[model samples]
Target: MALLALVLLAQVPPAQADPPISQPAGPHAVGLRVIQPAAPREAGLPAQVLIWYPADTSVSDAPPLRYGDLMATRLSALRTDLSATQLREGRAQQQASLMRRLGVSGQAVLDAPLQARSQAVPAPGRFPLVVYAAGVGGPADENADLFEYLASHGYVVVSSVGMGADGREVEETLAHVEPQVATLQALIRQAPQWTAADPQRVAVMGWSWGGMSNLFAAARDPQIGAIISLDGTREPALTRQIDVQRLTAPWLYVSRSPDTIAQIQRSGIDTTFSLLNAAQYAEVTQLIVYPMQHADFVSRRMREASDAGYGEYSRAEVRQAFGMVALYVRHFLDAHLRQQASSLEFLARKPVANGAVPHSLRIDIRPPAKP
Candidate 1:
């Protein structure tokens, strides 16, 4: 609910252009392409995905991806009449064009070109795969910065263009989680057509409701190499659906607040029926970012809030929160997806005071309790 509010409240009358934000500090340049994959099931959902990967060619000639379209599609999915409105009225395309004209398309990178299908790096030289699910009513590209960042760093990042929620109710949200995850898995299977992607070394991440879906997906398929949750929590109904006892993949949960953890515990989702529930789940590392909101995980929110002068933080402060989270994400993926053990040190270290921005990062690695 708070996650939804973050998206809703952050939207204000267009003001000055978004502040200049730092790009991901990866060595290789980023490339992006779009795909429309048919759902594996009769979910009536055609997954519109954005693929970001390492690029060998110059991407400066291309135009930035549309921000309004991604934001509009995401917002539409949250309402009950999405099909009748955006789908029937043809608003998605129109909205994207409008945003582009507004000069607030929210492009992740300036002029990152689409990589050619034929020139893709060959097999035996594939990159680790990552499928990221957006929060409820949030577009896959909501965290475009992170996706581009990971791709530039040599990981194939696949994110959906629009993950329809259809309704705002909690139960409606829960029912859609598994289907979205399944859709993501179906898209990953199309890796051979897009780039040199290694599906075997896959990682799945989500925010809020998507995080709940991430847990369900990992539970269903233990082969997932790792899981990342950006302030995601499991409801009582979700725990009833999947047995978390079967989850074994490594997990990284970064929370904006403790109330979420408290909610999970109160809902009886933290280790009552299953021996390996949240409290007993091994291989899970939890990180808390203080003075941050649920929306901070979303990069676009910071820029929008800063431009509108809506939130408490300044442009610099907002960029700082966004940067810290991005750094941790890069480190976590580097450690798990790339198998770089040393990267974990950045996550484990305590934050040092730098005056301008407060570094209130808390890390806790939880191993399975003694049986």
Candidate 2:
């Protein structure tokens, strides 16, 4: 599969190419913390949850959180046979690839004190919580760049490792999805203890399988106020299970290109039914990124994959589309979770009017159906 090919290529060293990644434009610096829930529902897999939050600007000088380190750790855990030398080489290759593609060393600082905890003054009001769900068998930090970007923008972002009931690759069935949903609920319940997260104003963001799982979590837990799916929510069987009436949360669905959709159809998979189409009672905003494929929605894959991974799109074009995805995600959260008037207006305008590259994406906004 293309995903397997990208993973294999990420382990190989790439030629140095400094294509700039759109850095987080938020004012606050980013801080990260990994918390092991006292009572995790899925005990079989690593239950450590990653929390990214706004941090004091002074901590920006702290050492950058190496993406390679995170990738290497997850890899070593999965493949116990790799030697120390092999692991080190893998780490180096991962970092080198990131540097080549993203043009940045790293964007986040590890365990830097939260803005509230660092200051002696009164704590600021809590930030909205965004629970991130990774793709099947993906790590908690699967979309590290997005987490950091959201954190910098003052949202408390949280994610856990994605695995099935067997503690391995997640399957697309209720039996497997139940554990993922449970993990999300557990994280939501523990948000207050972990950071300055406002549980009442919670949003669930997922990619691929995680995208579908977040819908399940939101359907079960009414506390979720918004949902963001990155090339997710397209699964027919999973979408059929969600009660759209219960999924009243405003949704932001970022999808792959039309060509990719056609390609899926060519493979004999039905591409007609979609959760986004079914949930008409709820407000929905969909952005079709013309350059991105299913895997490109995940920043790790976007940055590490070989040039061919982007298909006919240029690296710069794909990177631009990815950056636009982050911007839209931020505004969507701001509009629904923070109730910011500017963000609401931003979402209402055309993609070009909102500064997105022309022809790079298509946006459609559907207001909630009148009662």
Best by TM-score: 2
lDDT of 1 by residue, 1-371 (tens): 99998787666423323422354456666666665545423544344566777766444444444444344444433342455654645554544544564355333322222222312332235788888877766766677667766776778887764354442333444556656667666655666567778877888888877776777777777567888888885555565676556677778888874556778678655454432245365477887776567777776565344345435555555566556666777778888777787776765666553222445667777776554
Q: Residue 33 of candidate 2: its Cα lDDT?
A: 69
List candidate 2 segments past 4 Å from native: 1-24, 39-46, 59-62, 72-124, 260-265
Worst 10 residues of 1 by lDDT: 109-118
lDDT of 2 by residue, 196-223 (tens): 9997899999999998899899887989
Q: What does candidate 1 score on TM?
A: 0.71
For the record, the alpha-carbon RMSD of candidate 2 to the native fold, in angstroms, is: 7.6
Candidate 2 residue 4 Cα shift, in angstroms, is 39
Q: Per-candidate RMSD vs. true structure? A: 8.4, 7.6
- What does the lDDT come to for candidate 1? 0.62
Cα-based TM-score, every candidate: 0.71, 0.81
